[model samples]
Target: MNRKSRWAAGPYILWMIIFVIVPLVLIGVFAFTTDAPFDENSKRLTQEELAAIEEEYAETDEELPVTYKTVFTWDNILSVSQYLPVLFNSAWLALIATAICLIIGYPLAYFMSRFRASSQRLVQMLIMLPMWMNFLLRTYAWMTLLEKNGWINRIFGLIGVGPFEMINTQGAVVLGMVYNYLPFMILPLYSVMTKIENHTIEAAQDLGAGSIRVFTKVVIPLSMPGIASGITMVFVPAVSTFIISRMLGGGTNMLIGDLIDLQFLGNAYNPNLGAAISLVLMVFILLCMSITNQLDNGDEEMEGKML
Candidate 1:
């Protein structure tokens, strides 16, 4: 409302429009349109043009189609239908990773929230220490450790157990995702849980709430916003990741991100197809965020009604 506020917000608003809105518009244009291709044998070309082309390329058999004009079509989007299985695999893997994060993070977050200030700082630093390493390098370290003769297999060898294949599997991909994104889940839950006062929890206990009852009815309900935030944060990146799947799954587990990457930068070399896949991914992420937002709002409304 104030001029000072407007001035401060102007650059951020401009940045969003230039970066986000323009890119989405360009992707949509690419997804919905293509260069109208014509060949000498095609009926769209005139007979005279066909004769002229035959005379021109008589010495060689290399037939090059010419771009006639740009036309709008649904072919690019429709082409994505065949890749739905890849997309679904990405979603399923992401869901598994997110659920694992929540299971491991919820208790860790609660315990961290209950810590003394110094201890909380120490524990938080420990959680964040792994993230200081490069993402690619962290993944590489996992690769080294998960190899056939790696440390894990050696440990199993000492116990008279055979070394099982660990790397280049779906399990490896899921492990990478959980290891990398687990912190994203923990920090948000910790941030929200730390705000819940001890007196409120004690009051629930005073009213005959057992440990499980207090956690389910009071703590979990209050932490719904953080749960939603954590899911969105973890799921979005996990679903779109190509490097983890490629490296850990040995390129066999191609997710939608790998499919899009191949179309743009691999032997596929089709920017139009890549853009269409990116558009679909963007829509998927938005729908996820929308659902999370709805959950957050519903939780708020329920709390308001209770009060």
Candidate 2:
């Protein structure tokens, strides 16, 4: 890039430094440090000091406020073991949702990619139409459809199946995640699949490869970039989601996101612990992305060798 291109990136660099870099530094600082001890206005009192202060204040009919000195501690991160189940649940659910999205999305993308350009555009619009609505609203819409007396049950009732409990369950949370993030999986896969030339598949068929073999050996390997990108895009948000689990899982299925929210905003009110959880979650997401990148690289290398 030239000097002008570097200059054009100056605003983006400043924005990232101010918003991303600074906030991460602050979270790191808070995660490592606790309150400082013994300020001029707030001092830690010993038992004897407390007794003396109490005795002196007893005459005055006023009580002194107690304050503890802040210090660095590892308890916040160490205690994360207690919330290990929540982390596991988050990872498990996100994985399940990502897998479901991939299973459904790959076929859909493949089918859509074979359509004419105009038809593909129309289908793409339909796939993306739901996303134009607010995410909260879309999740709420699922709540209405999945609730016991919701539309799904009502339709099932006509078939003599009566209502079944659907909302406020792990399945509902997964449904919500899949519903919201499926587009993320589909669009990337479609973008990559559409770029594949028809002549490549034709050449494979000319070599006596069956439809299934051609798809497995040719189309999928070529679309690995989209697959990796979609997995990362879907899994990261699904793992960190709090609102879907809260609204759909009925607060019973507390994922890591809920735990972090509780630490910062709920009765827990511990920002240090929240920061620790956030840091761990960030590491998990980075690890997932790293694995995806490795898989993508491996696929590229294999493809190169085949060529």
Q: Number of the top candidate by lDDT? A: 1
How far in Å is the alpha carbon of 215 misplaced in model 2?
1.4
lDDT of 2 by residue, 177-267 (tens): 9999999999999999999999999999999999999989999899999999999999999999999999999999999999999989899
Q: If scored against the real structure, what TM-score would every candidate get?
A: 0.90, 0.89
Q: How close to the true structure is residue 122 of candidate 1, measured as C-alpha lDDT?
A: 98
Model 2: lDDT equals: 0.91
Local error of candidate 2 at 145, Å? 1.1
Instruction: Indicate the TM-score of model 2.
Output: 0.89
Query: Measured by C-alpha RMSD in angstroms, how accurate is candidate 1?
Result: 3.3
Q: What is the C-alpha RMSD of each candidate to the true structure, in Å?
A: 3.3, 3.1
Error of 2 at 7 (Å): 4.9
For candidate 1, the lDDT comes to: 0.91
**Total backbone collisions, model 1:** 0
Return the number of clashes found in candidate 2. 1
